[model samples]
Target: MDLSAVTAALELKSYNKVADILDNLMLQVAADGVAFHNDWPYAIHLLSHFYVHDINSARFLWKTIPSSIKESKPEITAVWKIGQQLWLRNYGGVHEAIRGYEWSQELQGFISAFSELYTKEVFQLLVSAYSTISIEDAALFLGMSKDDATSYVLQQCWTVDSSSGMLTVKKQPVVTEQKLDPRKLQQLTEYVFHLEH
Candidate 1:
C-alpha cells in the first residue's frame, strides 16, 4: 500500500488521521499477504496510537511486531516503554520515559503531541476528581515543574494556596446546548465499535 496518505496526514499535523490511515494500510497489506515488518515505520504508527490514548491498540501493535525488528530497533523499544508506562497509569513514569528517550526527527512531533494530549487529559481528570491538589502532584501529572504547573493551573482560573502549596481546581461550567458535529459523532461511533471487537 502507498504510504503517501499517511505522509500527507503527518505533513498536515493530523495525528488522529495518521492512525486511521495506517490502520487502513495495515488492513490492505494483510489482505495482499505482504510483509509489513520492514516497509513501514512501526514506531511512528505505534506513537500515533498513543497520540489518541489508545493504549490497547498500541499494545496489540507492539505484540504483533516481529521479535527481530523489536530487538534491532531501539526506537521501537523506547516507544513501547512509554506505552507500558501509559498502560500502568504511572504518570510520573510516563513523563520520565518521554524525557529519557532521544526520539528521532520522524517521531519527535508525535511524542510532543502525545505529551500535551496526556497533560490535558490529566487536567480534565483532576478537575473532575479533585477539588484540591498539591502543586508537586499536579506538576508530576502535567509533566511540568512546580512553577510551570502552578502557572498553568492559575491560567485555568484555579486558585493556589501558597502556604499549603495546593491548587484549588476551578471546574468550568458545562455547556449543555452545544451541538455535536455529526461527522465527529460518526467517527466516534466507528472508533468505539472497533474497540469493542
Candidate 2:
C-alpha cells in the first residue's frame, strides 16, 4: 500500500477515524485484482495493529481472528489463508517459519490470547496523558503561532491551547516559561513527520 495518504491521515488523533481509514484501505486492496496474496500479510499485520493499539473495538478483531483456521469462517477467512500461504511460500510454515519474520512465539501466543484486552487498557493510559499534554503544545513552550500549535495538536504531536498560551482545548493550566531545546525540537519534528506525509 502507498502509505503517503494514510500517513497524512494519521494526523487525526481519533483512533476510530484511523480504524475507518484502515478498513477502507483493506477494501481497496480487496477490490484490486492484482497481488491479493502479496498484500495479505500487510492486511493481517494491520489487523494485528488495530487489535493491539486502538482502544475502541480492539477486542472485536481478536474475536473475529480465526484461531487455527476453524471451519464456519467469515468470507474474510480468505484474507488470513492468503496471508498464511504467502508466509509459508516465502519462509516455510509452522515451526520452520522464519523466526525473524514471525512474531516472537511468546508474543504471538499472548496476542492470540489477549492482545485486544491489553491494548484497550493500555490506550486508557495514553489518552489520559494526552488529556494533560498535547504534542503540539509541547513544541510551543518557547512559543509559536496558534495555527501552527493547533496543527501539531491535531497531529498528536502536542496538546496545547488552540489560543497559544491564553487557552487550551480542555482549559488546563498553561505550561510556564520553558524553551524547547534543539534536541527536543528535532525529536518533535521527526515524530510529526512520521505521522504526516
Error of 2 at 173 (Å): 20
RMSD of each: 11.9, 20.3
Q: What lDDT score belongs to each candidate, Candidate 1 first?
A: 0.89, 0.42
lDDT of 2: 0.42
lDDT of 1: 0.89
Cα displacement (Å) at residue 152, model 2: 25
- In model 1, the Cα lDDT at residue 6 comes to 84
Give the per-residue lDDT of model 1 (tens digit) for 1-197. Answer: 68898878887889988888898899999999997787677998889998886888988998899999998898999989889998898988888899998999988887888888888888998999899999999998888999999999999999999999989999989878979999999999999999999
Taking all chains together, the TM-score of candidate 1 against the true structure is 0.85
Taking all chains together, each candidate's TM-score versus the true structure is 0.85, 0.25
Model 2: how far is 194 from its true place, Å? 66
Clashes of each: 0, 8
